[model samples]
Target: MIKKITCNNGLRIISEDISHVRSVAVGIWVQAGSRYELPQENGLTHFIEHMLFKGTATRSAKQIAEEFDRIGGNINAFTSKENTCYYAKVLDHHAKHAVEILADMFFNSLFDPNEIEKERLVVLEEINMVEDTPDDIVHEYLWREMYENNPLGSPILGTEETLNSFTKEMILSYMERHYTPDNVVISVAGNIQEGFLEYIESLFGQYKSVKKPVKSLETPAIKPIYTENFRETEQAHICIAYPGLSINADNIYSLVVLNNILGGSMSSRLFQEIREDKGLAYSIYSYHSSYEDTGVVVVYGGTSSNQLNELKTSIFDSIENVMNKGFTETEILNSKEQLKGNLLLSLESTNARMSRNGKNELLYGKHRTLDEVSETIDEVTLESVVDLAKEIFSHKPAISIIMPKKVDL
Candidate 1:
């Protein structure tokens, strides 16, 4: 079990003492991301995340990066649909340096106007880079059609137009409004000493308490719709998605198990039937993504141009069979075992644990261990998985297809 502590500013901290680990991970998390933005401010949160490392109160971006690497540490950050995280991993002896630097990056970033404009172009390039690749764009379309105008439906990297419109003032305001201590979490895992904790306390404990409480965010209404575009390409890529339960839903475990049976692994029904038996496509998989109040289950595949429609039909047929007939006892037993065995490899890194705990605390008010997660996965019976499949398939998932520019239907 990880130990939990609340800083003076109301920021929560979770720490785990792994008996003799050589490395440590420190992460800073805030309940701010694409889902937290207003329509006009859609991409500001992510923009601010980018600006954070450009410069802080006392360090330049290059210095921030180099100093960490100088100590044999690695650093990175990412913004998700529901949260933004900045983290560092280093030898256990360098824990103080990691937390101090992370604390500085978060609380004291300088939103330079010139830097903002430069980064604007940088992000624009990023958007362009993704558009240049079809695989990236198809996922965005799947989310858009599935969630429609809701925040959950929005892309974490934001759209080109929205990102271009982001300005320094917008980022500053967004950061001030959403990046509050009460909505933040700091997690450390490894060989941590009491002095390192004290140093962290000294660095972050002085942050001023946010004047406003974090009100619950309202998720957008479901927009069940289908969208299709004809693209000329040699290879056809497709993504089919449906509204699934959010993390807050009681049936989420069932959803996980249900996905395992659908296409989560090679032994999954979709992969075995679609790839091994029929040789319809080289790749086929189903996965689910969950946020605080929203979730989407998606099944994706790649096929020859002429087989796009056939591939689509095959997927729908497979889904319909699962929804109506459910999984066999063998499928359920194997999926459960596969899922449990996969859990151990997942916890090998402190960074993963840090990020995992930070987000869980923000959502569920506490952290759940791997054993607890496995138990929940095991407790998911075939009936429950079948029930979840029925409920999810009721929405009749939508599809997003990508293809080479030359192949015509």
Candidate 2:
């Protein structure tokens, strides 16, 4: 069963009880990320994530790690384009202790000046690591072309210039504005014991409620553009982007099914045609990235510099074939089953359940039962998938190519 309790301070507590499991997973989710940042604040949200573990008012970084080790619990955090989460998994008996430690870190982090200086170097090294990776850097270039002039297109890791300029004062000011009670959710899953709700409320309910006003953003129109970055590597990294559905769009299911058949797996058309049949590329795949108001579907692959043009032509041809002739009933059925199996298998994890609960609450403000989702996927018809293909593939893609420095285009 799933339950949600909203405290007097507007902090939400979402949980699920799986009595059979002997462990519990807890997460603190903040509705702040790169999308909530200004151009100058590109990476501050991620930086704050790193700093929270550095130390708190009463515990140094090593002591914090030691505490978790002593309890035989695991703790970590991650930042995305839309949110940040700090989570821990522990034996059910230690649930309260886990919450107490997490609360301490959240409410009393010191953000020491010396620690800030030290972490800056760590983050800078991270930025350099991404630049050194060509396959990773290519996707970053594609977003810049797809969402030109928009913060949505900015890299999650801000530039070296911005990281160097961030001070302790700057970091604190940003946190104060965004880390309000109403802007957070606490999600707990697995082995729900008695008084668990009361225990969480006791630790979190005392915070004063302050709601941050929502900011208005103008949605930038998508413009198709071609761009190429030259590097001294042996292979050419290429990506093509087409505008897709927003997070709430009704046609998202159709697009999901369509992506699977096209290039989502080894049996996908792009994989079978580009690599298996033609022997052109070693790695190829397709994926979608959706935000609150906009989204994009991208197909990416890497190949030798000499075969780059053939690879591009074959990708477009496969897309055009699907658009013109549409996919067969057998193809649609197989893809649907593949997607459903993947979704169902993922639910076997307590961590996956915790993540699903937290995300549904944060993004949609409600939860969908497993049956409800399976039914939605089952409702997708052959005509709907074909229509989605025509709608998506008809557009001329915005292409981003990265080729060897000395290779001719």
Candidate 3:
């Protein structure tokens, strides 16, 4: 079971300690991401994440890195459409140090002007890398096409204009506004000390702060947009997708089963039929990505330009098979087992448990136990899976295709 504590400033902290473990994973999560962006503020959450590591008021950039590395611990972070997380994993002996460092990174970030300028360039380069790779670029384009420029469809990396226009003042203001305790969750797992609660309480309890209203987001009327990028690559990377469901949607579990049976695993139909059977393409997969209020089911593969039509045919045929025939009881059971096993295996790492609990508390309300999660996965039936398949796969999904300039289909 996980214990919950509320800091003085109302930041909720959840912790789970296991016996005999030599390490602890701790994470700080903010319930904010691209889904919360304004038309002009697309990538600010992700940018702010990077800026925190540059330097804090009490620690230099190099000091931050060296300190974590010196402790023989690992620290990293990520920003998604619905949340941002910063975490560290350290030996149980360093538990205090881990929490202190995690807290310092969040509360004391300097947001130095020089650092902001440098990191902007770094983020710009990251964006450039995203653009240069056709496989990556197509997914972003698919979102824009389906959502028609809505915040739900916006790139996690703020657009070029917003990234270029951001200033230290902007970053600071955004942080102060959204980084309030009410928007934060702290989670720790494995080998924790009971005193850790008091430590966090004493540190954040004094954080006397008031609430800031979070900006509201609206999903756009569904519109489909498609464009072809003529890049210089041997095989065409064709990606197509449409909106799925936001996180916490009742249909989420069904979407998971549908995605897995569709192309999530190597043994999935997409890999078996499109690659193993016909030898059509080397990479083929379908995934249903969920956010807080919206999501997208993406299907992708690479093939010779000459095989474009054949590839399209195979994809449609696969969908048709799922919708009409669906998966058998054996397939459904195996898929659920796959998902359950993946979830259980992931928590073997202290970091994964910390990150998972942090996100759950921040996004939803409580972190369900492993047994609860297992039960939910087991509850997914073949009938429910088929219902989801028919409901989702029956639609005429919007499509996007990318290929080389010189290639003709």
Candidate 4:
């Protein structure tokens, strides 16, 4: 069962108590990410994620690491396109200490100039590493071409020019705007102790933001343009994307079902036909990324340059077949079962439960029980998925490809 409380200052705390487990997972989720950044602010959200672990007013970076190590707990953080999360998994006995350290990092991070310089170099190298990775960079190119001038298209890692320009004051100013109490959610799951909610409230509550929360972001317009990057890589990587539904769309379950039939699993059509049947590509898959106002469905495949044309042809043929034939009732039923199985299996992990509750509270301000979700997935029918497939495939896809410099398409 999930319980929720809203602090006086507007911070939200959500938790699910799993009595059988001996561990606890806690996550501090903030509604700040690359999409919220201005052109100049590009990667500031991710940068702040790195800075928070550098040190706090009372704890050195090494001490912070050692504290968790001493407790045999795990503490880490990640910045995504929509939000940032700092989380820890610890034995139930050590939950309080873990939460205390997380709160310290959250409220009292120094963002020291010297540490910023060091981390900036580290992030720059990280960017360089991605650049050298063709498969990874190809997806980055897809977003760039698909969203064009929108901040949604901006790389989460930011450009070297922008990264070097960030200042401590700039970081603080950005956080001030997006890190308001109302925009934060604390999610805890696993073997929660009695009074733990009160303890979290005491730590996170009472800090009022002087500024109003940031305004809703402008929706990005999709740009379906084709782009190619020629690189000295062994294979050609391609991504074909079409507009998709928002996170709250009524037909999201249908789209998920369609995506599963398309390329979401090893038994998926693209995987079977493209990789297994024709042996045209070793890696091929499709996925959907849904945001607040908009989303995208992307199909990606990598193959030898010589086989790139055949792989592309095969992918298009497979999608066309799906649009023309739709899916059988058996296919839809099996896909629904597969999705539900995956969902239920994932919930067995404390970390997964913590993340689900955090993201649900952060995004929807509501929670759905496992039964409710399973029912919804079951409600997805052949007609719904078929109709959604036609609607999605009707659009001209934005295409991104990275190929060997010597190869010509």
lDDT of each: 0.81, 0.87, 0.82, 0.93
Model 2 TM-score (2 dp): 0.97
User: If both were scored by TM-score, which would come out higher, candidate 1 or candidate 3?
Assistant: 3
Worst 10 residues of 2 by lDDT: 209-218
Q: Which portions of model 1 miss their true places by more than 4 Å?
A: 209-216, 231-233, 405-409
lDDT of 2 by residue, 263-309 (tens): 99999999999999999999999998777788888999999989898
- From the highest TM-score down, the ranking of the candidates is 4, 2, 3, 1
Candidate 1, 1-409: lDDT as tens digits: 6888898788788888886778899888888888878887776777888898999879999999899989999998888877888888999888887788887888788888888889988888887777766666788887777777777777777777887787777876777677888888888888787688778777877777444644467775456566655554457788988888789888888887789889999888899888998889998999998877777888999888778778888998999899778889888888888888887777788877777777778888877778888888888898888888888888855777787543443
Best by lDDT: 4
What is candidate 4's lDDT per residue for 1-409, written digit by digit as tens? 8999999999999999999999999999999989989899998999999999999999999999999999999999999888999999999999999999999999999999999999999999999999999999999999987888888899999999999999999999998899999999999999999888899999999888968888567787678898988998999999999999999999999999999989999999999999999998889999999999999999999999888888888999999999898889999999999999999999898999999999999999899999999999999989999999999999999999999964555
TM-score (C-alpha) between model 1 and the true structure: 0.95
Clash totals for all candidate models: 6, 0, 1, 0
Comparing 1 with 2 on lDDT, the higher-scoring candidate is 2
Worst 10 residues of 1 by lDDT: 208-217
lDDT digits (tens) for residues 1-409 of candidate 3: 7889987678888888876788998888887888777677789999999988988878998998999899999999999887888888898888888778777888788888898889999999999999888888877777777777577778999778999888887776777667788888888888887687788777666674444847577866456565677776777777767567778987688789889989999989999999999999998999987766677788899888888778988988998999899898888888999999999898887887788888888878877888987888888888888987887766668777778754454
Rank order (by lDDT, best first): 4, 2, 3, 1
Error of 3 at 19 (Å): 2.1
